[model samples]
Target: MAVRISKILLVASIGALLLLIALDNVFDYNTNYEIVSHVMSMDEVPRDSVISWRSITNPTLHKLLYGFIIFTEFAAAALCLAGAGKLWRERRAEAVRFNAAKNIAVAGLALGLGLYLFGFLGVGGEWFQMWRSATYNMQQAAFRFIGSIGLVLLFVHQRDD
Candidate 1:
């Protein structure tokens, strides 16, 4: 039962991570404004009206970017689950538990590496895009830090009955 749950979560997490990468690479400058205008009840401009980057830039992307981060973080959380499951199943076998934890920690680090690459390589636009791009970069940095800490904790707290 527990193993089944772990498998489900693991697969879901992997899917979410992949989707987040795809969204992070997406650059739809025009659609963003239309969505924002609809959601926030902003008045539409005349066809010839010139909109500043600040005006057209969808500050609403903040939510979208945060969502991407959460999805990746959830995947990392799944890695922790995989490690914990191994430890739980082989509580009496210290070597087995340690090996399981080490392996999952490595996997978590690899997932973080992928997230970093996605964020780093995906951003390309004018200054209007810079705000979200910068935010995503910071998010990638923070996730990398968290991934490092999570792996360190797994190694530090490895134990057996």
Candidate 2:
């Protein structure tokens, strides 16, 4: 029971974190938009680098990408919150039922993992060379998010028996 409660709380916490992040991005649009813009533009990378060709100089594309990120964050948060609620309602159910309640939470966590790992790290860090930008680098933060969310995901997926 304690473990189940812990899982529920952890999922809820992740949901809250994602929700706050999405809200922050919306409320303080320019702050994060700058980061995204810089990363996509690749202007911060070495001037002589050949990969500069991959840079996306279009402002409209930047806005669209940023919007997609926020949408994904909000979707993950909603899924996590709903999953936590489902877990809470089934906390006292039999092992099978409790385990079944984890489906939504797992989906949410997976979505978060995809966002941080593939979206930020893969696309931003590798493809866009965001890691080269001292001011715009988000690799560390994205790594932290991936690690924490991955851990919670693993714990939550454990069988409830």
Candidate 3:
């Protein structure tokens, strides 16, 4: 029971975190937009770098991509919150039922991991060479998000017994 509750809380916390991040991106639009713009533009990366050719210098595309990112975050948050609620309601159910209830939470965590790992770390960090920028680098922050989401995902994936 305690473990079940712990899992519920952890999943909820990730939902809350993603919700806050999405809200922040919405409220403070320009700030995060600038980060995305810089990363996509690769403006801060070394000028002579070979990957400069990969830079997306279009402002319109930046806004579109950022919007997609925010949308994904919101979707993940909603899934996690719903999953946590489902888990809470199923806490005392049969082990199989409780285990089945984890599907939503796992999907949410996996979505977040994909965003941070593939979107930010892979596309923004590696493809755009965001790591080369002293000012626009977000790999560390992306890594942290990946780790947190991945850990919760693993914890929540355990079968209830």
RMSD of every candidate to native, in Å, equals 10.8, 0.7, 0.8
lDDT per residue for candidate 3 within 1-161, as digits (tens), equals 99999999999999999999999999999998999999998888777977788888889999999999999999999999999999999999999999999999999989988999999999998899888889889899999999999999999998887
Clash counts for all predictions: 0, 0, 0
Report the lDDT of model 2 for residue 140: 99
| Model 3, runs deviating above 4 Å | none
State which candidate has the highest TM-score.
Answer: 2
Candidate whose lDDT is highest: 2
TM-score of every model versus the real structure: 0.36, 0.98, 0.97
Q: Show pairs that collide, candidate 2.
A: none
Answer with 1 or 2, whichever has the higher TM-score. Answer: 2
Least accurate 10 contiguous residues by lDDT in model 3? 44-53
Model 2 — TM-score against the truth? 0.98
Two-way TM-score contest, 2 vs 3, winner: 2
Ranking, TM-score, top scorer first: 2, 3, 1
- For candidate 1, write residues 33-136 as lDDT tens digits: 34323322222332343433233335566456545655665676566456546544554445544444446645654565555445423331222232233222
TM-score of 1: 0.36
